[model samples]
Target: MLKLHFAPNSRAQRSLWLLEELGLPYELNRMEFNPKDLKSDEHKARHPLGRIPVLDDGDVSIFESGAIAEYILERHKNGGLKPAVDDPLYPEYLQWFHYCEGMVMPPVNTIVVHTLLLPPERQDETVRGQAQRLLTRALAPVNEAMEGREYILGDFSAVDTMLGHAIYMSNRLGCVTDEMTNLKAYVSRLETRPAFQKAMSA
Candidate 1:
């Protein structure tokens, strides 16, 4: 059986949501969000960085939520969420899917580390401010693209989960505010998905 190493409110939610969307049965190896569970030698064996969202598929173990999502889609032959290689939307799909990690998360992670992860004494206002600004710039295009669209690619796809996770995290940091009407609506739409609700609660 497929097993997912997960922690609540982590990037693992992406994989969990995708799994639920695929309607596949998988084992959830829930763990606390702490060094004791994530940084342990046993967990490290599954993921070199000892991060959450490690997927163990029989003898194969993989990390990185994006990679794991792709693996699941490919392994399960569920192409519904992904555009075919020959499809024109394929490039756009790849772009937005990767944009979540490559473009958005850097600033989001920076803000998270500076504002939430680190102790108040160790947090730096300058860094947090810079990250917030960068996050704003990163999300502007996303908000614009979401105008008149229910999903990133105009249809419900895995790109939603990939980019949705980043948007969700940014919202938690107060980055997605009322002015960003499209994003706020987009989030509301995503939250309405049964799969998204299942993944979040899980």
Candidate 2:
């Protein structure tokens, strides 16, 4: 059985959602975020960066939420979490899957840095405004792409799980607006999924 090192309300939640969606039986090794604990040491061994959501499947070990999502989808290709490789929507899946990590995360990280990581006195107003502006601009393309589509690939795929984090975080950060109607609706649609609800409540 797979062993997943995770914490609730973290990126690990996405992996848990994927496991639930696939109906895969896995052990959830919940780790507490203690700076001075054996579990923290073990977690560091599993993930050099000491991040949550590390997957250990026998000899295989992986980290990073997007990579973990893709790995699970690939491992269970028929699980319906991912489109077939030959499917026309596969390209969109691949694009948006990477975009969630590459494009969206940069601005989101900037927001995190400016809003929380930096001290109020040292926080640069210009940097915060620039990050907000960039996030607003970057979100437009996602909003347009999701217009009239129930999901990023026009079907529920790993892209939804990947992009879901961005949409949810953006909403939490007040980055989402009426202009992102499609994206907001997309997030709402995802929230209705049983797996997503389970993950959220877990």
Candidate 3:
């Protein structure tokens, strides 16, 4: 059985969602989000950075949601979630999968750091403004890509689980809007998934 170290409202949610989607039985080692819990020496042994998602499978351990998602799909043989290389959209799938973390999350992280996460004295308005602008620009392409499609690759995939978290962060920060109708609808669709709901509120 897999052992997942989880913290509510963290990247570990993505891994939990993936596990639920895969219907894989695992132990959820829920932990507090506070530094005392995450920064403990025991936690640091699993992850040098003491991150929320540290998956212990037998003798091997994995961290980072993207890598963990891929690991699950590869082990479970769920090609629908992650298409094989022979598939036409395989390249595109990899692109969007990586895009979620690479393009989307950086500014989202910046916005989060400047806005709610950081203390008033540490927050920077200039950085916030710049990140907001960059995040908006980053979303415009996703909005356009999502036009006439329910999902990124026109079918549900693991990439959505990866990127959806970033979009959720954007939405929570008021980055999503009515003008981005397609993106909003995309998020709405993701929200309706039972696995998503479970991971979020479970």
Considering every candidate listed, which one attains the maximal TM-score? 1
Residue-level lDDT tens digits of model 2 in 6-68: 776567888888888788898988765444432466667988778878998889999988878
Q: What is the C-alpha RMSD of each candidate to the true structure, in Å?
A: 1.1, 2.1, 1.2
Selected candidate, larger lDDT, 1 vs 2: 1
Better of 1 and 2 by TM-score: 1
- lDDT tens digits by residue: candidate 3, 1-202: 9999999888899999988887889999889988999999999999999997999999989998888888888876556488888999899899888888889899998987888788999999999999998898898888888889888889888888888778887998899877999889988999999999999985
Q: Which residue pairs collide, candidate 2?
A: none
TM-score attained by model 2: 0.89
> Tens digits of per-residue lDDT for model 1 on 1-202?
9999999889999999998988889999999889999999999988888898999999898899999989998887567689999999899899889889988999999998998799999999999999999999899999998889889988899999999879988988999968899999888889899999988888
lDDT of 3 at 172: 86
lDDT of 1 at 143: 93
Stretches off by above 4 angstroms in model 2 are 33-39
